[model samples]
Structure formats: structure tokens, C-alpha cells
Target: MTSVSEGRIHGGAVPLITRGPLRTTLRAGDGVRIEAVYEPCTAGAAAADGAAGAGTAIVLAHGFTGSADRPAVRRAAEVFAQRAAVVTFSFRGHGGSGGRSTVGDREVLDLAAAVAWARSLGHRRIVTAGFSMGGSVVLRHGALYTAPGVREEGGGRTEAHGEAHADAVVSVSAPARWFYRGTAPMRRLHWMVTRPTGRLVGRYGFRTRIDRRPWDPVPLSPVEAAGRIAPAPLLIVHGDRDPYFPLDHPRTLAEAAGGAAELWLEPGMGHAENAADESLLTRISDWATAR
Candidate 1:
């Protein structure tokens, strides 16, 4: 972890070592590396005692421009750890992971690798949760990879059991459509910084000097991928007062998921606000354990 004078911490060499369960690094097909953190389900343990009977695990992903150490990510991990194993890692170039950030385009592959790592650890029941851009990755995972339970444990016949899929998914303050239609404030910010400064930061690291492309392409849109997660439980939580994404983003996702998914609208809450809310944390814990 290298610190910059401007207070921005870049995570590349500093690795997060976890001993609670198991820790590993996954190398994606695209040559990007992802760190995987896991906590096991133990009987009578402080967190998983309540969820010990479920035998489930959670694979968590952080939002855009944020790492696994973000406050929200840590809080959610602690909450979920009470009942089940919690796994989180940095997407490419964001935290201790390698490679440059491609927005959410290639990040999806990092997420897939994380999920695969979780499955290898004997997590038959898996639930994936992501924040903002990370949420978009969860939705994309549902579309690209069949949920964990889609196949039988040993060699039995594949069943259409809803439990076979990700029992539950949570997305916080995610944007349904950012590349095409973003909020006014977000558009203004993009116009102000994306042209020159954003390009410079992306090209020559955060503090270096260089010129790069104006806009990074969006390969996957939440609105387009929402419908693909059908038959699996999905939850979209967004702030009504979010300045970057329109309030309708969550609603659009809910509608796209048909009745299988639901949306929670947080009044007066900005983006990522619910992450610090005690009540919201409890709700997330309860929801994840219900499966």
C-alpha cells in the first residue's frame, strides 16, 4: 500500500492477509489477478453461530473506485460474518489487485474468478453482493455464469431448484444506465474531469502525467442485464438523494427482475449511505441469513 501526498491510497503491493477461513489469489484468463478473502462457517462462532445451519457463504464485491477496505465493505463483511463466511477483494487496479481498471468491462472476469475460488472452498450455497459498479458485476455474473446450486453436489441430476442459484443478491446504489443516460450531476462531473484529468489519472497512475482516452467503454449495462437474473432472488438498494445516479435506476432494475427481485428506496440517503446505517446492516444480515 503506497500513500500519496494528496491522501489517496493506492493498493497494489500491500496484501490483506486473512486467517479466519482461507485466503488465496485468483488469476483470470485476461491475466488480471484478484485477491480472495474468506471466513469459514463454524458452530458457536461469534458471527456464524446464527447461520451455522444454512451452510452458506457470501462473496462480496466493492463499488467503483473503491477497494475491499472501504468502510461500507468492511461493515457489511462484519455483519455477514456473524452468520456465514464472507469474502471480498479488490477489482483490477483498485486495491492490492493487478492490472488497470477497465471500468466494469473486464472487472466482470475478476468477479467470476472470485466466485470460482469460493466454490472451490466447499461453498455449495453462495450469495453474491456488490456495491455500485460491483453490483453491476453481480448482475453480470448471474447472466454469464449459472448460479452455484445449478448443479448437484456430487453427480446427481441437475435440478431447477431456486436454491441452486444464488440464494440472494444485494446491490447498493447501482446505476442502471450510466454510459447512455447518467444523472445531471454525474454528466457535469464527467464533462469537467473525464476529458483531461480523468484521462491523465488513468494513463499515468494517480499522480503521474500523461494523456489517454476521454471515455472508457461500458461493455455491460445493468438495465440490459437485469432481466437475465430472473428466477434468482435480487435486491437493489439505492438512495433517492443520490446525485450521480437517477432514482429510477433501482426501480428499473426491480422491474427488469420481474417479481423475483425487489428494490429498497432510501429517502434522503445519498450514495453508499445505507452502508453505515445500523438498521440497514441488520436488514442485510437478516435477509442473507433467511436463505
Candidate 2:
């Protein structure tokens, strides 16, 4: 789980200068209630873009152990709000939402629900951008549900499934596969997600309850799913110095995506949303808007 206050603060002027995030909830694939908020783009952005970006929206998925209010998450949202509408949500179990964390598997449903809400609000061009685990979820979500009239996962997993889409996707510091513990940070994370005592610590110490169940059949790896995001451009961003995944994760995903994806291995970056640079975030915002 991500620490709540470790990074720079954002949304300081949220209620005063900018409109507060409109609150809402949507049931995920397994019917777990997911907490979510949609922040309208800063006033006059539609006019400034000559309304080209009017139908566009950006959905942000925070990292493991993170909630919508985490400073880094909020900062990214605030920065994006200056460009277009922003939707940020705590994947089930991470914040004011029901259910336990499935790490990155069931979180795909949470991202789906958020994307559905964005589309329901009439945003025709939606981009799903996530950090770390959330980044992996966005990739899977985009791959699984990019087109309508296609069969996707359903039954008990979520009430409403499929049809949600990410016209463009930006995955920041996400791993290519599961059970990665090569780095010290990831080793600690594996401990937190796999052990009972570690889960207790997660529940009390980090406010995250990682599910103990192993992935049933194992969900599609991010590298595998990257192939499906073609036609719809994919951006794989990783820090060259990322403690959790190093450079290979992004390389694998980019190779899977082939020419349909672009990769940016940041020079001095670390891991996930919290460690992402502001310039990188702005570049993501620009990418989403252009798509």
C-alpha cells in the first residue's frame, strides 16, 4: 500500500479555486461497491481548447495501498484538471470502498466502473491512466473492454461489465507480470500481500487489506494485454531507476504492443504514481488529450 502523505500536496485550493470532485459509487464486476469522484476540468478549459477536448476525460488509477486522496494521486488529478475532466477512484478495499484488495486482478473491475461512469457522463474520448498496480489495472481494463458488442468477464465479479473503454492508456511504473519480488521494495510488497501477519500490518498500518486468495487462473499479464491495446495507442512509462520493476517491465510491454505503443524509460524516476515526475504527468495529460 502507498503511504498517504509522503509526496507533494495537491488540491490545496480544491474547494475554493476549483470545484470539489463530485462524489459517487459504482458496483464492480463482483458487485463490490467502489468509491469514486469526478472532477470537472478547470473552468474555461473547454473554451480554451476550442471545445476540441470537450468530449474528452482522463481517469486516474492510483498505486497499491493508495486512495484517491493520497497527495501524489491528488496532485496528478489536480494537474490534469487543468487540461480536462478527471476521474479518480479508490479501487475496492483501498479507501472508502467495500471489499478487500485483490492486488491488481479484481481492480480491473474498479477501473471498468470508473470508465463506465465517465462514458455515461457523455465523454466520448476517455483515457485511463494508472500508477503501478493501478497502471496494470488500466491496461487490463482497456484490453478487456475497449469495444462494445464484445463478450467480457461477468457474473458475480461485477453487476455491469464490459463496454467501458480507454481510447488511450498510460501505464506508469507497472510490472509486466505477477509475483515479482526481485527488488527490495517488491520483496516487502510481496510480504505485505502474501502473509497473514503482513496483511494484518497492511490493514492496520497501511489501511490496505490484501486478499489471501491466489489468482485463480492468473489474469493476463500486462505484456500480454499490451498486444490487445493496439489501434488504440498505448504508452508504457517506467523509471530507469524504478526500485520495483527496473526497465524490463516497460520494455516487455512495449515489445508486446509493437508499433502501436510508445515507451519512455525515465532517467531518474522511481516507482509508481508517488514517484512520478510532474513533467511526466503533464506529458501524460498531453498524450491523453491528443488521443
Candidate 3:
């Protein structure tokens, strides 16, 4: 359970001034206080059960070099919160969390903490949704805990962190595999992770705390993880116009997922949650809610 005494939401909302997000630091097992916010649905939905108009809740994971406060992340949270209670958190090393990001490797612990916090708050049906790096985390985290007690390969080093019983999973603009430097954006990303100058830029400019070391064993690939999210529905959303990984990445994940996953490729989109148009977000909101 998330400890309120240890980490509490900083401020309360004034009646007419602002409906601030309910902010708290969710404590990860390794002692990282993952900065998180539980945003109830719009006022209309707030009046309904579980503040979602339904029992389902959405947990959104931001992209690489992004935190919860990023405009793109907030926009997605705002849209999704219209249909379901949205839980948005900064992965360890991003925003207010403590730790250097191992990029996609140890981030699963961050997501697991948020998911467990949502469950503790009485959200029964949880939808694990992520963008880019966070998207890959969602896929691997799902595969890690098909059963609550039996820990699997992808849950990082620790034991079964939490029961990865997401009712639905959505991956937006995620990479199928790591160390992919095929595109200009990815090449730049590699530099940011592997070089000192890039690390400095990531730390100061982007506020993304990237680790110096590479994945030793290398965590499970998104395509490999996608295959394990069976029985629990998976939605793979990618952009045909993405600069990072092309449509082939999504196709690979979709192929691994077989019939359990639905692949949607947008025509004029760029990457991650930032490029997700309102119409597409609406469809996503509907899909998560309906299922």
C-alpha cells in the first residue's frame, strides 16, 4: 500500500480557483519516491462510481526523456481522464523521482508502483497505458506477472513486484527492440545515453536522468513481451510517419501478439503522445473504456 505519512499530496484544490491534480509520491520498493498524481475524471464522471463513470482506471506512462509535467503527457492525461480516472507518474529518474534511469530496464518497478497504488485506491479495473519507453515497460511488465506470485523474466531483478493484472494494455509508438539506431532520432538518443556530453544534455536540458551503463543481460524485448500479454487485450498504436522506429516495429509486436493485439497505424502522425490527435485519443479512450 502507498504510505500517506511518508508521501502525501502536496496541496488541496480551492473551490473556484483551480482543480489541481491530487499529487503524491508513491514509494517504490527500492526506496524511490515516484512522483505521481491521481486525476479523477471530469466533474461529470467524478459524480459517478470510482470517478470514472465506470470502475476502470487508466495508468499513463510518459515517453523517453519525459516527465509527468510534459505538455504532451498532460494532454494525454487530460483526454483520458474524461473517460476514466487517470493515474500519471514520473518514472524513477524523471521529474521528482529519485534514481538514474536505466532507460527501459529498471523502469518496470516505477510502473508497478503506480499500478499497485491505483489498486490500493480501490480502482478495480486498471488499464496500463504508456508512450514510447513507457509503452515498452507496459508490455514487459504485463509479461512479468501473468500470475500474482509466480515472478517471470521481465519484472527486472526483484521478485514479482506486483500482480500485473491489467485489464487492458496500450502501447503507443514503442520500439520492438533496444539499441536500435536506424533513424536520426534514435542515433541522437544513443549518443545521449552512451556519451558524457549527451548525458549532460539529458540531465540538464531534458531533465531525464539517464544511467551510464548499458543493460548487461538486456531486458526482454517489446516484441517478446507482447507475445505474453495474451488473454489480456493489447493495443499497439504507432505512427506511419514516426521518425524513430518505423511501422515495422509495431508490425513486429503485432505479429508476436497475434490475434490478441490490435495494431493501428496513423498516417500523418509523428511520435508518442505528443502527436496523438484528439480524434485518435477519443478512439483510444473509447477502446479502453468499452473493453
Best by lDDT: 3
Clashes of each: 5, 8, 0
TM-score for candidate 3, residues paired by index: 0.87
What TM-score would candidate 1 get against the native? 0.76
Worst 10 contiguous positions by lDDT, candidate 1: 1-10
**Pairs that clash in candidate 1:** 11-95, 47-82, 47-83, 48-82, 149-164
Estimate, for each residue in 105-210, the C-alpha lDDT of model 2 and write its tens digit: 8788778778777877667778899899988888887777645554444512222433376788999999998888888989998888888988998999999877
Query: Candidate 3 — which residues are off by over 4 angstroms?
Result: 1-20, 43-53, 147-164
Rank candidates by lDDT, best first. Answer: 3, 2, 1
RMSD of model 3, in Å? Answer: 5.8
Clashing pairs in 3: none
> Model 1 lDDT vs. the true structure?
0.63
Superposed on all Cα atoms, the candidates' RMSDs to the truth, in angstroms, are: 8.3, 7.0, 5.8
lDDT of each: 0.63, 0.78, 0.79
Candidate that beats the other on lDDT, 1 or 2, i.e. the better one: 2
Count: clashes, candidate 3 = 0
Model 2 bad stretches (over 4 Å): 1-20, 43-45, 48-52, 149-162
Model 2 worst lDDT window (10 residues): 3-12
TM-score of each: 0.76, 0.87, 0.87
Q: Write down the worst ten-residue block by lDDT for model 3.
A: 1-10
lDDT per residue, candidate 1, 52-142, as tens digits? Answer: 4245677787876677766777777777776677778888777677776655666666776666555555566678788777888777666
